[model samples]
Target: MAIRDVRAYIEEHGLVETADEESEKSIWRKSGFEGVRSFGEMEQILSRFIREHRDARRLNRAQVGIMVGLHETIFARYERAFSKLHVTRLIHLCEILDCSPIEVVHAAAPHLFGDNRKEADDKMKLILCILDMPALTAASLLAMIEGLVGERERSGD
Candidate 1:
């Protein structure tokens, strides 16, 4: 189905307001099953993508770090998925790997970015301009996002 149709269905059913719980229940009742991922699941997907891309390119952590102006230890942490990635650094990593942000993001969040290819491509470019920061900042940003999501849920707006 088109994204518009899916959005209309979700709105009509009050699914987005309910998060995955209500949506999954309704989908499972209608169909046989529904799959929902936790935040860690998405993280793992993204981590695996980075690791696989590095392996495919035959680039070691040290090599990637040198290319990206980071130390080998820091880059190793990123490769191991132990570091919280800033979008700007992720963009640089993509450039070094000769890959697209849209590709990586979509691989990590297919349910979100896959259906809308053009939109994903546009977002990839726009996010490149986001400021670089450490993992702690990324964690804080995630917390803020969760807070906003909670507020939206509570306000039902």
Candidate 2:
């Protein structure tokens, strides 16, 4: 479904406002996301991702609900955007679906990966490649990356 449709559903269900009543801000306006333009889009992306992952695994809402210890209707609310998906609940759902929580986050905010789609896609591909590597190889790469990052930090890059 389109984000607009999800947004409409959320509005219709009276789920659009937080208790704080602050206006929604673009993700980029927050610290560490200075250039992002996506605003208030994560909820839609998250709902879609959850539903897609569940479908891909051939699991119904009831099955996933049992795995996550939530009632089927409660879990369905999340996928239907009638309720917000908290981080802890997202982690539990991801575990049950055998999907990476980071993947869902990436889908919600690709700008976190890079400044543009191509750059983001490249970084995401690199990340997936690292995940597919042998454990020792992955560890070696991690160490190398750490060393490079440390050096860059020391050099004020």
**In TM-score terms, which candidate is top?**
2
Off by over 4 Å in 2: 1-40, 146-157
lDDT of 2 by residue, 4-119 (tens): 57666665644433322235442113212433323335677799999999999999999998998889999899998778899999999888888788788788777678867788
Listed per model in order, the count of residue pairs whose N, CA or C atoms clash below 3 Å is 0, 0
**Candidate 1: how large is its RMSD?**
13.4
* Best-performing candidate as measured by lDDT: 2
Which pairs of residues collide in candidate 2? none
lDDT of each: 0.67, 0.77
Instruction: Give candidate 1 regions above 4 Å deviation.
Output: 1-34, 113-157
Distance from true location, Cα of 98 in model 2, Å: 1.2
RMSD per model, one decimal = 13.4, 11.1
Q: Quote model 2's TM-score.
A: 0.70
Candidate 1 accuracy as TM-score? 0.52
